[model samples]
Every structure is written in C-alpha cells, then in structure tokens.
Target: MNLGYILVVDDEPEIRRLVQEILEDEHYKVAVADGAEPARALYQKQRPDLVLLDIWMPGTDGISLLKEWSSGGRPEVPVIMMSGHGTVETAVEATRLGAYDFIEKPLSMGKLLVTVERALAAERMRRENVRLKRAAEPDTFLIGKSALMQRLREDVERIALSESWVLIVGEPGTGRAGAARYVHYHSARSDRPLVEVSLGAVPPPNVAVKLFGAEQGEAITPGSFEQADDGTLVLNDVVELAAATQLQLLHAFQERRFMRVGGREPVPLDARIIAISDLSLPDAVAEGRFREDLYYRLNVVPLRLPPLRDHREDVPELLNLYVDWLVDNERLAYRRFTTGAVNALRHHPWPGNIRELKNVVQRLLILNRGDEITEAEVEQALGGRPRAVDSAPQTLFNLPLREARDLFEKAYLEHHLGRTGGNVAEVARLSEMERTHLYRKLKNLGINPKAVKEP
Candidate 1:
C-alpha cells in the first residue's frame, strides 16, 4: 500500500525521475511536475500529502508558485524547497511563505527521507489536534462511580468492539460528544481520524456538501465522510438535518457508497457512523422530523447517556475532576470546595447537565478569590438556591418576612435567568416586570447577567 501521496516538481527531467523513483521505492505514491503550471494542475486534481518544489523552475518560479498557494491562508500540505544554489535570504523567504523546510541539492536521500517522515508526522498531529478540539472535551473519560455510570461505561466499551453504526441519545450537554470520543479512542480504529460535523451549526443549503464533500472541476473539498474514512464520523445534532439530506444519507448508507456534491464517481463509505441527538430517533420519526429508514439503520447499537440529576451521587467526583482539570490545564488557582458547597451543588438541579456543571466550576474558580469555596459562593455562582435534601422546614421560612421575601425574589429571578440563558429582557417578560426594573433587581441580588449565560 502507498504510505502517502507526494508531488515532486523540478525543471530537470532527470531530477524529477530520480526523486520520484526514490520516493516510490520508499512505498510512496509519487506525482512529478516539470514546471509551475503542471504542478498547480496536479495539485488541484488530487491534493498530495506533501510537495517537493524546486526553486529555479522556468516560467513561474518556485517562490511565485509558493506565494500563489500560500495566498489563501496556510497551504494544506507541507512544501519543502530544493535548490542547488540556495541563499539564506531565499530560504527565509520560503519559510515566511510557509514552506516546511529548505534543503540544499544535490539532495541527501537520508535527510530527505527523514524530513519527509517528520513533515507527514507533523501534519497528522496538526489534524488530530483540530479534530479533538472540534469533536471532544478535554477529558474524554467518563468520570463517575454510580451504578448508572458504571453500566454506561460497560455499554460504551462493548459498543466500541463492534463495527455497527451507533446512535447516542441524551439531553443536551449530557456528555454525548464526549461519549462518542470515548468510543473512538477505545476502538480498533483509534489511529484513524475522528471527524465530527455539527449538523445544527451548518446551514441547510450546505449540509450535503459538508457531509459528502464537493468536487468543482479539479478543486476537491473532502467532507466529513471522506475525512473520517477507516475511522469514526460523528453526526452531531442529527435531528437538525433536513428531510432531503436525510433521504440522501439513507441512500448512501444503503448502497455503502456516496457521491460528492459535484462529482459522478462513487466513493465507498468506509467510516463508522456515530449519530448523536438530544431527542430520541423514534420520537423524531414519530413526529415526522426524522427519517424512519435512516433511524433503523443508525440505531443498530443505541447508547443512552443519563443526565447529571439522575446520577446525583457522582456530583462530588465530577466537581473534583473538573477542579483538578481546570487547575492543571487552565492554570486557574487551586481552590477546595467546602463540604457545604459540595452538598449544595449536589442538591441543585443541573438543567444544562455536565456542560453546565463544568462552566459553573470554572466560573466559581475565576470569580472567587478565597482558597475555599463556601455554600454561599456556590449558590451565587449557580444563580439559584440549592434545594434542601432533608425534610425539615426550609431556611426561607425561618427568616423575617422582608428578608424571606428578598431571598425568595433572588431565587425566583435567578431561576428564570438560568432558564432564559441569561437574557434579561426575556426574564423580564416572563416575570411580567419592566426590563429596567428587572435589571435593577438583578443587580440588587448580585446576579451577573453575563456570567449566568451558557458558554
């Protein structure tokens, strides 16, 4: 099998043939071009994993060609410059133009081979980082000791061992995407790409091109399907897809191949599909919002993620995990949660689920200067009073009338704020109060409108 595809461009036929032979012998698929025009055409036709360009080609020189490629942001592939009469200034210009490295000729096969390997490795790492940022959280491991969580872990592990398509259904921010990443990392295809497409974020008109890729003339844009070949392709918020797109996807799955938006050739679908949605597929299909045929195809292995409130027993562990993670990764100051604070957090209803809890932890750490976070601080951060777990008369009843009224008002306003995602005007309308007065009340209660907004 070809290790990687490479394009070698040199004015001399002898040099081109020698370089091509060397790369081909090393198990690479090599394409050679004698000048800038052919190199451009070759690059557009089939984008190579790397490019080896000669600096002194006739017509459009290497520098001009490099400039043209780099004009549209950074070049997707690495370009290594080659020149027999190389100068420091020329090398610097090439480097500034985003060339991977500059090598003097006659080329040293040893150095050339090593450089090629490093360039490919670096590109892989870059792509991996981008994929992780888009598709995963900082911590992909499911953190909990509750029986519900333990069973979920076992189910995810078992599903990872299979090649069948997976459908993950859960409430928003319930770690659905994180669960997807967990499966991909534990599966046999861990070394391959994990491409995620958030269908809800993409426009309806562009969803097809985003998923199946697009080919306009020689310019090719590989979509999530092509990028995740031999690996996992996560379709996030799958319920957001239009009916037409759903039908197209169903046909592709049925045929085990897909055609690009503007291309005739069929590309085999080699990816493991992992579809995620906050709503159940059956519910979507019953409501006529999703395709029934596609639902059955994708739901071969279904995984349900429990909300934070269902497994409230794991709140302390999650709190500690996020605290340590934030301290280490974000360089946030170390702070311990008081027992009261922990208890308060445990009793609260996490409407936003795990993501909300994480954001709350971050907000608490950044806003509070004390080394220990108290229950009052947690209450203020959450924007509402934590429900009493015990069956005793509530503290609100014990306070004086005016003080009790103030506390009730604070909790009431904060609850609406949380529900509205910190939209003051919306909260005001919901409460039947004027917007200006609502702002004043929020300020008086020490509620930060911006802080309560979901990240």
Candidate 2:
C-alpha cells in the first residue's frame, strides 16, 4: 500500500475514527482531529503526505482552512475533501480551493486507500522536483551590479518586504524576467512554486488557456495560474497580449480570480501578480490598445530599468564580472580586455541590452584568446564600424541617449544580418549571441529578412 502518515480532519468524531482505523489497518500512520483548526495545527507541525478534509465543520470549515493553509505558505499538500451531502457546487468549490479531489461519503474503504496511495506518490514526485531544483540552483540571487542595477536591487529588497503587486517595464534585453525573479525570490512567497508565461512565446488563440488557465476542459489542459497558487506568476512580453487578453488579465487582477476557457465559475488566485512589458507602455495606452485601469493597477510599484546603452559606464564592470563567473563555474582561465577594447565596448551601441553583452563576453572567452582583448578584435568580432554612426551627419556626443542607442542597435543588427547573409547561426556565432537572444532582438527591431529582400 506504500503506507504513509495521513491527517483526517472532520468535525464528526465518528467519521474521523472510522477513517483513521481504515487507513491505520493499511499500515498507515493516521492523525485524527475533530475540527479544521486542530487539523491545521497538526498538519503544520509535521506535514502529512495526504489530508482527508470535511467541508462542514464548526468554526472553520475544510474549504476555508485549505485556503488559509495555502496562503500561509505550507506547500501544496494533496487534500481529498469528503462530504456526506456533496453537490456539484461544493465539489467544484473544494477543487478550486486547492483540493486534489473530492469524495462523497458513505466512504468506500478500498477506493479511499487507493486515492491516498496515488496522492502520496504524486506528492513525493513534487517534493523531489523541489529538492533537485534547490540542489542545482543554491545561489538563485539576482546577478548584476551597476548603478541602474543597484537601484533595481534596492527596489527588489524593498518590495520583497511588502506584498504589493509589481509591474516591471523594460526593453527586450533589459532583464524584465530576471527582475521579476528577484522580486519573487526576496518576497515572503519565495518558497512556493514560480509560474512563468511569455505573452509573445505562445499562440494568441491559446494564450488565455495557458495564462489565466483552462479547466479540465473537453479538450486542453489547465493553465499556469491554476498550478501556481500562493506563489509568484510572471507574465513576460505583456505587450503582445491583445485587447481581449488584456481584459482577461485586468479581470484576474481586479477579481483575484479568473474563469478559465470553457469554464463557468471563477477560480480564485492566491498567486502574486508580477507582469512585464517591453517598450514604453504610454504609447500603447495612447494608441487605445491597453486598458488605462489595468495599467494603473499593474503600475502600482513600477520598476523601470535603463537599457544597456544608457548604462554604458557599467560595461567594463559587467565584462569583469562575466570573466570571473566563467572562471569560477566553467573553469575557464580569467581573461582580461585591453583598455582599447573596453573603450570600444563603451562607444558601440548594445541593442540587445545585458544579454547581448553577456553572450559576447562568453564567446570571446571560449572562442578567442581570452587574455588581452583589443579594440580591433572587438570591431572584427561585432561588425558595423562605429565610424558609420560617427559619420551619419550626427555626432555621437550630440545625439540624445535613446536615439543614439536605437541607431546603434538597429545598425548593429542590420550589419550582423548582412554579414551572415540572413544566416542566424553564423550571425549568432560571429556576434556571440544566443539564438533565442538574437531572435528576440530581431523581433524587437521588427526586422524580417525576407521583407528586406523583397523590398
């Protein structure tokens, strides 16, 4: 029977004793409690592999207690709610409140034991995943140190101390996802599972089913939020979530719940909302695309980050940091960039933000001579003569921060695309960018290689 300890929570003494005896006879350790309050206390002291909860209780019923325990940061313990007078509504409510399954009483002993074993097996698998993740990523702290970065670090620390909703705004390569992660990690809800969804990564037709989530529909699976209760749920590239999806997001924000596709009742969300969008949101609002009200709610604790170009002064520091990381983890010997090469990095525009810079540094360390990088080497590795920007009827010093940076990003990407003859692999290899990062840059710039050829 793969016996394990189980908690039986019912106000009925008879029900509790009968269930305990049935489970104990199967070589299981059973803890009996006459009410929800006692069940919660005992479960907290030593978390059972499974819980049998009753909906009707004196002070706090089973459903209410489950909500309380989930919000209190106890992990997702598999709960099977049992009721003598179970209706469709009550069963649905129990499921929504995070019960694994609901059983109508006149309890079937064999069926109950089978469900307990299955729940325990699933619980074991979930705990194993958590343990493996902890082992792999012991130091999950945010990685970056610059003036803008320091400001972000301070923001995360401050927000972590509070439970306010967070809205992160930045360009594609500006680390919005990474920023969202930091907030969750430092917050009180760090121990719960993290649910991440990218607005641009999924198909529009299926976006709602994935984010707000779908019920066990006639077809399709449950969504991210359904799986991420009492934790952090991040929506990345939120700009791509069309008007209808934005409305759904706003509803989820305002109601603390959402009815999944083809589902009737609203599934309450206990997960914290942290959404990110690239580009200026004001433009979207002005275009009558994004809802103003939704904007206001999400902008509660706005975290605006400067792109890599604005913080060019931090380039040398980033280089040194990456080199140290490569040495420590990858066992690569430390490499140093020459003063001229560092100077070149500062002058060129980094459109892809920190991601592009990081990739370039790693490539130099691995593919080229790690020691003593030069200006000529930087120019050769990442093409587009800085002279082009200098000679474009505009002086680099005279151009505004954003304009100059955009030119650099566009020019750099165009130059690389040309160098590879629209070959992404060669472009990523020569430019030292990850394929995904490079594609993100292409999408952000609205560049289509086929269109450039046709035009």
Candidate 3:
C-alpha cells in the first residue's frame, strides 16, 4: 500500500497547519483547505485519498459538509469527522452522512494514524474482493500457489478418484470443509448432491438414528448418509462424536446396510462418506473419546491440511489471486503491501490461519478506502505492535510504557511491510515516520524490505 494523500479541511489556521504538518511528517501528501468551500473545491480537483473534516468549520459545519460530500458520490473515499465541541447528535449525524469514523478533539497521534490506516486497509480488501469475484470460476480448484497448498491439491486429486472414506485433519480456518468440497466435487458421484451433516450437532440418543437408517416402516428423519445415496456424505467435526456414536458409525461402515429410524427394512448404503476434523482423531481415540475401530475405518485414506504459518510463502500469491479476481481487472488503485506491512504479516503467527488472513484483507479494503496501509495501521487493526528485527526484547504487553511501545512498534512494522508489498517509502509514510529515520532503523536492524517482495 502507498501513502495516502489527505485533505485536512478546517477553519482554524492552527488546526489546518497542524494536521498538514502531521500528515506530511508521516510522508503523506497533504492538500489543505481553510474552510469547507475550499475543501470541497480541492477535493473535487485533486481527489485525495481521505478527508479530515472539522465539525466546527466556518459556514457549513462538519455534519452538513459530510452530507454534501456523500451526496456528491465521492462517498467511496473515507471521511473521518473530527470535533472539539461535538455533541452525540453531531457525531451520529456525521456517521449517518457517510463518515468512516469519528475522531474527537485532542486526538492521540497514534489513534488518529491507526484510524486512517485501518480505513485504507478496509478499502483495499473491498476492492480485492470485487476483483476475485469477477475472475475465478465458481469451482476453481486449489487456486493458491503455496507448497503446502500444492500438497493439499495433490491429495484432493488422489482421494477424489477413490471410494475409500477419507479423514481430513487441520486447525480451525485451515480450509478443511473447502477441501472436502473439492474432493466431493471431483469424485465419481460429482453429479449427485453432497449431503453434509455436522457430527457435533448430533447428541448420543440421536446418533444411531442419524448415521444408519432405522427401517422403512420406522419413522426415520432420514440421515445425511441415506440422503446422499449414489453421492457423497460429509461428516464434519466428526471428532466431537462420543464413543457410543463412533461405534455405531463404525458398524454401519462395515455392514454397508442399516435400518432407518424404527423401520426394520434394511437398505444398502450407496453413499461415499468423507469425514473431516480439526483435531487429531487418533489422539482423541487414544484418549478414549473416539472409537478406535471407527478411527481406523475413516483413516483408510487420511489427509492432513497444511497450517497457514507453515506455508507463509504463499501469502502474497494467494493475496494477489484474490485481489485480481475481486476488483475487476485492476480498475482499483491496485495498491500492494509495503515492505514493512508484508514482513509484519509474514512474522505473524496466524493463529486463525488462512481464514484470518482473508478477513484481515477484507477489513483493510473497507476501512482504508483509497490509501495504502502502513505498519502503524496494521498494528492498530491487528492489536499487535510493530517491531524491528534487532529491537530489544519485550513481552506482548508490559507494565512499563517503553516495553509496550517496543512490542507495538515491531508488530506495526511487520504488518505494514507485509500488506503493502514491501515498498519502504509507502511504509514510512503510512507509519508517519521520517524516511531518514526509517531507513537508518531498517539498516541497523538488517531488515531487507525486498524479502517481502511479491512472488
């Protein structure tokens, strides 16, 4: 992401100068206006990234001006409403008029910068989403380019050709369900409906009634396996099944025949069952929570999905794929991550994995609008501080101010570089840090901005 060109429109000369200096000091290009009328004029002419409109401006106030701006169809640009003597009504009005967020008077520098950065990140994600929507087919398989992802795709392809039950394991947000869909979609019975049932939702008493049918005469509610005859049945979160249900499921798999509900009539099972779990079912079986026989039955062709951190190499590629498909052929600014943003993203633990990354990108596009996001913005949005490679050690949070600052700084820098495609100048601007200072720190810390370069 690049630095934003901000329009600081205020009546007070001090306020105007202060904002202009602050934005410029942060490496942002500034377009200043002394009043709302002038602000409107400059906004129309230059089309800056964001607007900082004062609530107490002379003539048309912030609320009225916000309304005017929104009606002007420039609502896509994020407008942050600021007020020194603002009432609740005034703030609400500003929001109603399409302001991204409200900033009260005497704002903290960090808070202001973070708000701006978040707004821009959000906008970027939004545009990316639109692009992705336009480019990919509805069922594109393994569009990602990471090594871990390639392995996953190969497994999916291999398993899709077989009737053997597959057990997929991974952390939450690791795309287990998505992978299951791929296997089913490519399988022999691809034309038939894929019946999905969540094992976690089945209680003990209803377990038998769900997997195998009771009987023809019995009033069975019809389990997914029965409904998926000649197709695929997906048992999601199967790890949550109790030992008793596991045993029942195991028997059904071996016999390939079961009665529905209370009916005594036996029906040959025609569906191919594919079960997935976020937890290691083998471990669960050892704990006596899962049935060993069922675990082995489902593990006939087990597949392990890769965690996001292990495949950090694919982050940018996947991001780019999604972006290209989302924004409709780069009509958007098509801003990439700065070096600092990308590095931060790379260093991130990604506890929530790919899903988390997707959500972060979405948030960035909606929040940031037109401007490129910075390290500081990434930190604030992610609740992690930016850090330099050679910075002093500090806990995530600390009792002292210095310690907290250090942690935040590191997190900020990493996220900025990761998200902005590793552009250093853009990162410094978004972070509101002097270019000279940023360069010196990067050099001293031995941080190579190019390390986050796009693949």
Candidate 4:
C-alpha cells in the first residue's frame, strides 16, 4: 500500500537512487529525476504529493527551478530542499522560495523519513483547510419533512445516479446550492473534490480565467474546472454571467473540453457541472439575459426547488433543525419554540424562503433570553403581525365601526413603526401626521414605539 506519491530530484545518481529506495521502502511511490529539466517535466506530469529537490543540480539549479515553480504563487505540492554543500544562505533562499523544509545531504535516514512524513501531513492539513473554507455553509443537505421536500430529496437522489449535468432553479434562499451539494455527496464521484464558485460574485473581466484557468509560460493556475476535475463544480448564480462568458461556457460544454485563458491546448472537461440560478433559465433566455444554447446544455436534468411558502408544513421541522443546528454549531443559546410560535411561523409568508426562516430562528434564539420562544417573540423577530391578523381584513367587518376603526389604526401604525424601526418621527412623516398627534394616537392605541423597534 503506497502512502503517497513522491518525486526525488538530484543530479548525483547515488543520491537519487538512495532517496528513491528509502522512500519506496517506506511504502511511498517514488519517481526520480537526474536534472532540473527532467525534474520539471516529472513534477508537471506527476504532480507528486511531495518533492525532494537537490539544490546543486547541473543546469537551472534547484533554487532557480523552485523560483519557476513558485512564480505563479506557492506551489501546491510541498518541496523539501536537499543539499550536499549546506549553507545558511542557501537554506534561507530555498525556504523563501516556498520549499517545505531545508534538508542537508549526507541524509540521516531517520530524519529524512520523519521530515517526509511531516511534509505530507502538513500538505494534507493545508488542503483540508482550503476545502473547508471553500465548502463552508450552514447545512450541506436540506432540512424538511413536507411532501414537497420529500419529493425534492427523491429527485435529487435519482439525479445523483446519472452523470448528466444539473440545473437547479429556485427563488432566492430556496437552498438551490444545498440541493446541488446533496446531489454531489450522493454521486459516484463523492470522494473527489466538490468545488463551488459563484459566477455572480466574480467580476466579468476575470470570469474566463476563473473558470478555465490561466497559463502564462511556465506559470500555470488551475481554475475551478480543473480543481474539480473528477468531482463536481457548482456554479452559483450562473445566469449572472456575461454574454461572452455564456458563449464560452456553451462552447466548452459542446466540445467537452476547454483551453486555459492563454494556452492553446484543450483540457478535458471531466467534472460534473451543477448550475444554480434564482431565475428560471427559460425565462432568462426569453428575456435575452441568458443564452438559449447554454441553457439547453445545463438544463439537461432540471431540478426546481420549491419555495418555503409552498412547503409551509415543514416550517416547524425546519425551525427545530435550524435551532438545534445554530445551538450546536454556533454555540448559541438553545430555546424551544412553543406550539403557538410554531403555528404562527407555519402560517407566515416566507418571501425570503428558508434562508429568512433560519435567520429568524437565529435572531429569536439570540435576542430572547427566555427558555421557550413564544408567538409574540416570533412575531417580533419576523418584524410583522401574525398572518391571520394581517391577511384577514374580512374579520374586521364584524366589529362595530368605532372598534374596527381603532383596530385598523393600531395595525396600520404598528406596520409603519416596524418599517421605521420604531422611529415615531419617520412614521409620522410618512403618514403625514404631526409628531405630537401621532405620539398621542400611539399612546391611545397602546402601541409602544420602543417595543416595536427591531433588535
């Protein structure tokens, strides 16, 4: 069982042979190179986990080769510099050039083995950190038990069995990205990298370079496509891409390969593409905002996520999920929702969808110090009255004129106060009422301005 792939570069045949044998004995797959050119070729081809580089090579000494490798940035693979004629200056230069560690020749077998192990471990940690940073999110999978949610899960599972590209469509905060992740995690290529990039977040000028990578002479930068080679690439808000970029992407899909920004060689498109968009691709095409050809290519396996309002029955379950998730992950105070609070939330119109619900749950847990979340606290957190009160105007007709008028006034004033963050003056201005009159009215209606203010 090979531990890791390692490349050994040394001008001295004896040194190369000895190092290769030692690494191979330690269950590592070893590749040897005699000089700088062969070493460069091998490094580019193999992309070893670690490089054991000899400093005093024949042509283009190890320092120069290291500089070439590090020119683009720190090389992805760790390189340990080996030198027969050791010097403090040489070691510093190598370290500065991004070598993992400096190792003097007349190599101690024990130290060499330990250093190799440490370098590989460090590289693994570094890659894991990068992966975590890129993939960080509140939840990797959807949380709901409603019929709509169950159907969505089933669809995602079925889609994961295929190698076809997926286009996930949903309104904002509908967990389109989460759906994409679920598909990837359940797919055959789950063991490989799952790279996600928001096309909307990237600038138009750099979209090509970001997606297809850039190659300037010896310096090569692998973009999202290459980084996700064997796994999945989730392109968020893909409809936000520019016209030119959309065409370029369409060409890549059509040809099944793409060239780097500056290079002529076409790299194979091996990763499964999972595109996400708040807007429907068909609608975007109808509006001439998105290319029709690109839409067709990506929409091969279309998956539309239902908005939270459509799955209102799942509100309680989702609330509990987020509450527990926030408490466990964010170390936030745990607070159980009362039946009234849960019922109120189930009837609320979630215009911002699941994202808004999670935010509301988080806000309620953080701001309210009570052991249980009540209906009033839920309403306050949502910045509005319960849906029954706000959505039902017919019920007001049953009351006498005076009572109905007062009820209308209180509801209207409270809405304004909520909108203005309890700014009485702003509410008065908007209502075209004098500050003094509005204050008296609010007092008469028992609507406290300070109480209405959002936390």
Best by lDDT: 1
What is candidate 4's local distance difference test score?
0.78
- Residue-level lDDT of model 2, residues 288-320, one tens digit each, is 778888889887888876777677777787777
Put down candidate 3 lDDT per residue, 19-136, tens digits, no spaces. 7887788889988888876775575444467888888866777777676656534364689988889888887777777888998888677888899889877766765564344334
lDDT of 3: 0.67
Error of 1 at 318 (Å): 0.9
- Model 4 bad stretches (over 4 Å): 1-8, 12-48, 71-73, 106-118, 129-141, 186-188, 254-256, 287-289, 386-455
lDDT of candidate 1 over 1-455, digit per residue (tens): 88898999999999888889999999999999999878976765566789999999889889888887776456667999999989999999999999999999999999999999999999889877876665534642367899998898789989998887899987555788788887887788776778888887798999999999887754567778877877799999787789999999999999988888997678788889999976445656876989898989988898988767788889999999889888987899999999999998898756456776787788899999978999999887765565311111134454334334545665577667777898888988999999876776665444577766432
lDDT for model 1, on a 0 to 1 scale?
0.80
Which residue pairs come into collision in candidate 1? none
- What TM-score would every model get versus the actual structure? 0.71, 0.61, 0.52, 0.73
TM-score between model 1 and native: 0.71
List the global CA lDDT of all models: 0.80, 0.70, 0.67, 0.78
* Regions of candidate 2 where Cα sits further than 4 Å from its true position: 1-147, 216-220, 331-333, 384-409, 412-455
